[model samples]
Target: MTQGHHLRGIMLASVACMLWGISGVAASSLFAMNPDVSPLWLTQVRMIIAGIILLIMAQGVGAQPLQLWQNKYTATRIVSYALLGMVPVQLCYFEAVKYGNAPVATIIQFLGPFIISLYYLVFKRTKPTRSEAIGMVVAFVGTLLIVTHGHLNSLAISPAVLIWGLLSAVGVATNTLIPRPLLTKFGSLSVTGWGLLVAGVCLNVVKPLWQVHLTLDWAQISMLGIIIIFGTVIPFQMFAHSLGYILPTEASLLDAFEPLAATVFSVLFLSVQLTGFDLFGGALIIFAVMILSLDAQTLAVLLHRRHSRNTD
Candidate 1:
């Protein structure tokens, strides 16, 4: 790929992570504003509304949003991606946030990248570039610092909450791995639009929308709206599109930015306290991305023993 395309992919993925972070803050606001809000119902609404709007937009953009269903194979993949990938990701992350808190949820959810990396290593028989290996390590340390506020043992863990968090991570991996062919063949907008729509429709079978009701005030409405547009629709499109331009692992590593965005938003809008650890952690995350982006392959080969081993 050209350098310009790589830059574009990096930019899209980074921006998507930022918006997702902001959405995390927004979703947290919904929980605080009204404890009665159902996680299931909230997820259903976000997916359905965002999905419907995206389909319309996809059609307007001539993406042939309905064409995937014309072939049985593509149609089956669509359904699998929706039910197994999108549905679990959207719902599990919400449940994690609802129970364990966003910071805990985010760190756990990032396990997706590791899963992706390992998949490539074992199943695909590909080694990570030296810079990528280093970046993953840096990102993990940075994430831990940010989420734990430099206190690793400070987190309060519940069994169910932990399970939900882990599932969110698996969902992330599933979402990233399952849709590559479809995204390459179809493009991000239509796949994501249809994926969300299918997930919403399928979920409705078990948790019918009419079965749940809750109080909705303007604050709740605004938050929900933010989650739908900024959180659900826009970021997924950018993330999916970025995959066409960059490796899935690169996109996953850049996801470290999400926690940083969430931390900043929480401090600025939610009156949460920010500490030096947060700043240092955020800086490390950025530094990790910089490390991953460097084009100095020869230097990496000289510095990383694994490269020499592979060469041997």
Candidate 2:
């Protein structure tokens, strides 16, 4: 990629991360306005709005939507992707947020990359490097710190919420793994759009049109629009585009910024106070992601090659 493209990709990906990071705060705000609004209903509305907007954008750009049924294999994969990956990830995430605190839910969900690494080690027989191992350890320490509130003896976690949070991690891992082949064949935009549409349609079963309250003040409507556009549509597309210019590992590492951004937003907007323990835990998480971002072997090899060439 050209330098200009690389810079643009980085900017877009950063924007996506920023938008995604604030989603929890947005959801929290909406819920604060009316606690009566169920998570299910909110999710349904978000998905439908996001899906429609993406569809319109796709049509405007002349990108063809996936006609999965025309090919049996593609159709089956699309169905599986929607049912297992998209729907479960969203539902489990919302459920996790409902059952547990947002910080806990997000930290657990972020464990998806660790789980993916584990899967690669076990199934693909790819051994992790020292850096990766260190990253895992650091990430685990961060989780422990977060869960225990830095007090080892005061680790009082709700079993149901913990289970749901872990389930969300699994959903994320599954989604990341399953989409590779489909993405290679159908392109990320098409696959993502279809997945959103399918998941949105499924959600509508619980929230009929008449049941959805369309009337909203300007602030509420603006929040909804932001969630639909920046939170959902723009982020996914930018992420996909970034992959063209940056390595997957680099892109993944950039996403680690989401938690830090979320925490800052939570502190400023939600008045969520962070203790020393929280700071320590956040440091550990950042360290872990930084470790994972480095390719130790590649760097070592390149340095050695350079030295040899210089000597020669």
Candidate 3:
């Protein structure tokens, strides 16, 4: 990529991160209005609305052709991505936030990268490089610190919430890892939009329109719309566009900012109190992500040394 293109890509990616960071605040405001609304229902509505909007926009901009789904293989991949990745990730995450605080849930969900590394190690039999290993350890330790609130002895997290949070992480990892090859064939907007549409369809199966009541006041409806536009649609488009110039791993490292930004927003706007431990733990997690984003050559050297030691 040219320097100008690189700068534009970075700007786009940063915009995505900023919008995603503010999503929690938007969701929080909505929840405050209608505490009774189930997270499942909310996520379903948001995805459907965002998907429709994107579909329209895609057509308008000619970013996606009329026969976007003409290929059978592409259709299959889109369906799979939506059902397994988008749906589960969004549902599990909202559920996690319902059960636990948003900041905590956001931090937990950010564990997707580490989970992706672990998944590759276990299923693909791929050994993690030394830098990856260090990153994993640091991130895990940081998570523990955050979850336990720096008081390991007083760890009293709800089991159900923890399970949901971890499952959300898994869903995110699957979304990121499974679509790599397909992404080469299809543009990001096409993949994301179709996947979102599929996920919306799947969600509707559980809670039909007859069961859902759109009784929200103007404020709530406006918040939901903003969430759909800014939180879901805009960020995805910006992130996808940025991917043309930046590598995926680098983009993911930049995404680590979302959780940190969410934490800050939660504390500032929502008046969520963060103990000293929370600050410390959050710092560690950010540090770990930075280490992981280091150049691959450094990681390769470290991995080589570890392999040599193992042979010895």
Each candidate's TM vs. the true structure?
0.77, 0.84, 0.88
State which candidate, 1 or 2, has the greater TM-score. Answer: 2
Off by over 4 Å in 3: 63-68, 153-156, 295-312
Error of 1 at 115 (Å): 0.9
lDDT of model 1 at residue 89? Answer: 84
| TM-score, prediction 1 | 0.77
lDDT of each: 0.76, 0.70, 0.74
Pull out the clashing pairs in model 3.
Answer: none
Evaluation by lDDT, superior candidate among 1 and 3: 1
Worst 10 residues of 1 by lDDT: 295-304
Q: How do the candidates rank by lDDT, highest first? A: 1, 3, 2
Candidate 1: tens digits of C-alpha lDDT, residues 1-312: 999999999999999999998887888789889998867888888988998988888888888988989988778888889988998787998898787556556656756655555566677576777876887798788766766776778743565666887788779877866665676567778888888888988888877998877889998899999999999788988887887898765775677788778777877887765567756765676676556646334323333444234335
> On lDDT, who's better, 2 or 3?
3
Cα RMSD of predicted structure 2: 7.0
lDDT of 3: 0.74
